[model samples]
Target: MAVSLTGTRISVVALPWFVLVTTGSATRTGLVAFCEMAPYVVVKAFTGPLVDRIGPRAVSWTTDLASATAAAAVPLLHVLDLLTFPLLLVLVAVIGAARGPGDLAKEVMVPEAAEHGRVPLERATGLSGVVERLASTVGLAAGGALVTLLGPLTGLAVNAGCFALGSVLVGLALPRGTGRAAEDPAAAPAERSGYWRRFGEGLAFLRGDPLLLTVIVMLGVTNFLDAAFASVLVPVWARESGHGPTAIGLAGSVMGAAAVGGSLIAAAVAHRLRRRLVVLAGFLLVGAPRFLILAADAPLGAVLAVFAVGGFGAGFVNPVLGAVLVERVPRRMLGRVNALGDSLSWAGIPLGGLVAGAAVAAAGLVPILLACGTAYFLATNLAGLRPEWREMDRTRGRDAVKRRAPA
Candidate 1:
């Protein structure tokens, strides 16, 4: 997870800076991002069934290793004087492809790990969230320092190393006989369908379960708003506010640090909360105040305060989502289901970046920030009105179903 968290943060921050510096066009930078992410979403959607079929442990390490190799190749080519814009695009796309499956594997492991230890899924998921936030916190700070001191390629180097390290950890650290393997005897039934058919079955599950569908849509919109804010507005706002690139980097680090704090707190107390209500409140906290605070054109201290609060709220979100997913998905289907849901949730990101770039260019930073934040707040809350969210139970429902199966 550390490798994943650090590697992703480094790539995300470093890539944009590299493109912006080299190409000198925000739109073009966004297009590079779009090229990497669009294919990422599409490919990951199909890979979910494969994960379920093959199991997550293999999926995680293999993909991480592949991603590391691709990432390492980028700098080697650059140093060899063979790198070009198109080549950079292809390298980043490869990283994206690997990252999608790697992410699904990690998420699928959370519940299983919890069950193996006789811990609640919420608690385990909270720890997962903390790991992510802590990784972001450390990675963002390191990314800033590396980019500022050693340049963007240095950050990319760190990213590649982290992916390689994460692959090693996943391959070696996790014990066998965790999570879902404890519950199901019939999970790996004789393969009755082709890989494509099984993948379609996963999609069918999403289509039939309105609760899961709503959660996916909600997460998708939230991801879109976050991408717009992070990729476009935050950097532009920092420059316009006279903070420059260093300040942009620092702001990200600060937000990530606050998120880490939030997630750690969540890990300590996540079991006490009611999932549905907390999620609604978290959305309100995370979404409503960001644009308003940014538009206020506050001082540096005030800006940091606003982001800290927003990040804290965001920290509260992921664990609940993770727990919900783990509890509900059959062990055999975890990879495919997780991949599908995650792909849908992340699908809006590239477009969000593109839209934010256009909006910032046309409408200026503050107004667009306000509008996007407001839209995110509204969309998330509106999603909560659906009956499925309230009806779902992360604990009792799936466990009861498992118990009822014949011995």
Candidate 2:
């Protein structure tokens, strides 16, 4: 997961810059992003049942290989003078399509990995979050340097290589019998029940859990804000401030480093904490402050300080969410349920890039940043006031989750 995600973080920098410089238009940069993430969200929603059936291990390795192929082709074709804007869009779409299931596969495998290591689930997930932040730190710095020194294509090629290496690791490094589909009472007979039925079961489970629904809804709004901030607002800010891509990378790296420290603390003690309070507190720090800081015309030092604080707060989030899902969803239904939940939360990601670009074009950077910051503040704070959020602190186990009716 770290290997693949690191490469993805690099592309996060390389791909946007590639489009922005080439087109000299923020709209097209976001259009390219839309071309990628639209397929990611749509395909991931429908991929749940398939991941459950075919198994996440196979899905992980194969789709990663496909992503590598598509990612590599962009630079290769560009070098050959065969890469048009349309062709680049098509390749990125393929990468995104492949990535959706591949990423889900990795997520589905997390519990199995935890069990194999004999680690507590919350700690394991916290460790996973740490890996992600570390990836962002290393990959963003490397991406910035690669783009600055060697060009964006070089960074894209490195992403391809990372994907390929990740494929080899997933295919070979896991223990025997580790990545097989989870077996349950529904397993044998459900083979004949067909895909839509399985999908419906997952949806029904999610709908019955108001807490999970609330979490997903709140995350959907915040994810939209976050996606916009990362993909457009920061880049534009860097350009406007004459700080360039290096500053963007530095800000990300500093935040990511702080997040790693936060995750380490969470791993040691978050399980003992009241999850509802931690989550609300984390969201408070992670949500709106970064956007407002960027809009403040503050020095880079001030921006980095706010981002580090936000990053520290971010450290508490994923571990809690991962532990919640693992505790509430049966392993057999994990792929479908987790997939649906994540897809819903991520639904606005593509639109985030698109709307941020269009919003900035109309209103300019500072106004859009302020508006987005306010929206983010309202989303998290208001969501925290809901009764369902209290369930975040309730204890749950797979046995308890299974006792809940499929209805």
Candidate 3:
């Protein structure tokens, strides 16, 4: 997860900048983002059953290898003078397609890893958050420097190398049978069933849970806003404000570093706190403010401060969210349910960059940033008021139960 996600974070920084610099069009930059994430959302949504039946271990490494090939081809072709916009889109789409299943495979293994260690779900997921934040911090900082120094192609080359390394680690480094298919009675029968039937079962499970459904809808909206922020708003802000890519990297790394601290704290004690309050407070801190700050043309220090505070708040969110989902879903159906939920939360990602780019072109960057901030505030607040969210605190896995030490 660390190796692969770090590579992705670098791409997140490099890819948008590459298109923006090369094409000089926000809409085209967004189009490139759309091509990648659209396939990510669609393929991830449908590949859940395969992850379950085929085993996450096999699915992860194989798809990652595919992603490595596609990612490597971008720079390879670009260097050979054969790269074009259409071809770029095609390669990114391939990367996205492979990444979807590969990511899902890695995610579904978290709970089992926690079980083996007898660690609480919150702590386990919090540690996972720490890894993610650490990766982002390192990747973004490095990517920004590499892109600034050598060019975006250098960053792209690094991304390909990371993907290749990720495949090797998953395929040959992990212990045998680490993420093998579940051995549930349901698992055996379900393995024999048609793909659609398995997928339908997952959908049905997800649809029946009001809390999960509500979480999905809220996150879908927030993720869209986030996508807009990361892919377009920040890049445009950097270009217009004269901060450039280095500032973007610096702000992101500060935030991510702070988030690592937050996640560590959450891993240590978040399970003892009221999950609902933590989530609500985290939402308040994470959203709206950064957008508003950038819109106000805040100084670099001010921008970085807001981002750091928000990043710290952001750290508490995913552990609680991950714990909640895994606590409710049976181990047998975990992969599919997680896949569906994640894909739904990410569904609006492709459209986010697309819409933001067009909106920036039509109106301006500040207006879109303000609008995204306002939307984020409203979505988080309204979602908090939903009765279904109370359920977030209701479920707890056996592993999450703390045992008293003998005197």
Write one digit per residue (lDDT tens) for candidate 1, span 225-250: 88877776776776578765566667
Each prediction's Cα lDDT score? 0.76, 0.88, 0.90
TM per model?
0.92, 0.96, 0.96
Which runs of model 3 end up more than 4 angstroms from their true locations? Answer: 186-191, 397-407
lDDT of 3 by residue, 164-210 (tens): 99999999999877999755563456445778887888999999999
Ranking by lDDT: 3, 2, 1
Off by over 4 Å in 1: 176-193, 393-407
Instruction: Give per-residue CA lDDT, model 2, range 176-283, as digits (tens).
Output: 887887666655575535899889989999999998999999999998888899889888898899988888888888889889998998888988898888888998
Clashes of each: 2, 0, 0
Question: Which residue pairs clash in candidate 1?
Answer: 48-336, 112-179
Rank order by TM-score, top first? 3, 2, 1
Best by lDDT: 3
- Which regions of candidate 2 fall more than 4 Å away from where they truly are? 186-193, 397-407
lDDT for 115 (candidate 1): 62
For each of the candidates, the C-alpha root-mean-square deviation to the true structure, in angstroms, is 2.6, 2.2, 3.0
